[model samples]
Target: MTVILNQSFTGISIGAVLLLIALGLTLTFGQMGVINMAHGEFIMAGAYTTYVLQKSISSAGISLLVALPLAFLVAGAMGALLEWLLIRRLYTRPLDTLLVTWGVSLMLQQLARDVFGAPNVQTHAPDLLTGNMSVAGVTLANNRLFILGLALLCALTLTLILRLTPLGRRIRAVVQNRDLAEVSGIATERVDRTTFFIGSGLAGVAGVALTLVGPIGPTMGTNYIVDAFLVVVVGGVAQLKGSVITAFALGVLQSVLEYSTTVSVAKVIVLVAIVAFLQWRPQGLYTLRTRSLV
Candidate 1:
């Protein structure tokens, strides 16, 4: 029972990380219909932002806290710039966006290598997050717990922004029907850029949380990009609730499978399961209901 509980917590923590990574893709790819292969680089940028702040500041905790908002702005600005310079021109051509962003991703990786060098870097987590706590015979890592809370908080904040804010309403309007939204006097282009900013910013936040649990490096984002996309696709594009549910479900399943099998084998099993599930329901766990003719 104790082992089961521990694994479950671990799964939940993993799910939190997935949720953070996928949340941005949900906005960019899922809602906007742009295959941003460079999205992972945005995560890398956030992680590097944390690293840079830590180098300048003596306190790990202060640096981390500062990194959160700074990373978001840095990544969000990059996303907005990308949209203005290239993605905007190819919004109607997803394949072009994919190829272009893939090239951009490679460029970003090379840039990181040039700037930070080829060696992986490590961040020092604060003492508060370096310890472990036991709850009912289950040991919980403070870092993981912090990550879980941060993920939940981010999800909730995003949900509120989408559902209740004027900007979100504009974004939804543009997404549902760009032509109609423009006809209705909404600045669809600006909305698109703003949406991209928020989405990419979320990826930055995910990157910051990740520094607590893993090594930082130029190629680190590549390791999780596919899994993040899987979470978004399986959850259903544009369906926040579906992404949330799918993230945790896959996490638990992966954790359980990894306990009995090798990590590679566990990943293979999960991929197979996702493939089977998608074959049965390719629209994913949820479908968007839009009134637009297009």
Candidate 2:
């Protein structure tokens, strides 16, 4: 029972990280119909930003707190610039967007290699997050709990933004009917830019949380990119609540399966399950009624 409880905690922690990574991808792919293969690169950029911050500050707590906003700004700025320079031209061409973004992902990987070298770097947990607490013989790491809280907070904040704010309304309007939104005086272009920025910024924050789980590397984001996409797809694109729930579901399922089988085999089984589920319901677990971009 204790072991099971520990695994559950671990699963949720993993799920939280997945939620963060998928949040941004969902926003971009769901809202704009853009297949951004370089989304993982933005995450890599964030992890690298944290690494650099750790190096400069020499205080884990301060560096981490500082890394949060700085990583967001850096990744968001890069995302905004990329949207302007490349993604803007390929809005109507998803295949082209995929190819261009894939190329960009490769470029970013190479750039990280050139700048940060080929070795993986480690980022320490903050002093406050360095220990574990035990309850009923189940140990919970402070870092993992912090990550879970962060994920929930991010989800709530995003929900509020989308539900309660004018900008959120504009985003929804544009997603529903781009032409109508434009005609109604919504700055669709600005909305797109803002959405992309927030999406990429969320990916950056994911990268920061990721440092607590593993070593930071140029290709670190690639490790979880597929799982993140699966979360977005399985949850239903453009559905924030669905994404959050599906992420945790997959995370826990994977965790339980891993306890019984090899990690690779567990992933294969999960993939098969997701494939079967999709075959049954291609629209995903939840969907909102929105007009197609056509």
Candidate 1 lDDT by residue in tens digits, 1-294: 998999899999999999999889888886568988888999999999999999999899999999999999999998999989899999788778989998999999999999999898999999999999999999999999999999999889988988999998887777666788999999888888999999999989999999999999999899889999899889987568888999999999999999989789999999999999999878689866766554
Model 1: per-residue Cα lDDT at residue 62 = 97
User: In candidate 2, what are the lDDT values of residues 1-294, reduced to their tens digit?
Assistant: 988998898889989999999889888887788878888989999999999999999999999999999999989888888899999899888779988988999999999999999899999888789899898999999999989998999899988998899998888787667889999999889999999999999989988888888898889878888899899889987569889999999999999999989899999999999999899878778776655553
Best by lDDT: 1
Q: List the residue pairs that clash in candidate 2.
A: none
> How does residue 112 of candidate 1 score in lDDT?
95
Tell me the TM-score of model 1: 0.96
Residue pairs clashing, model 1: none
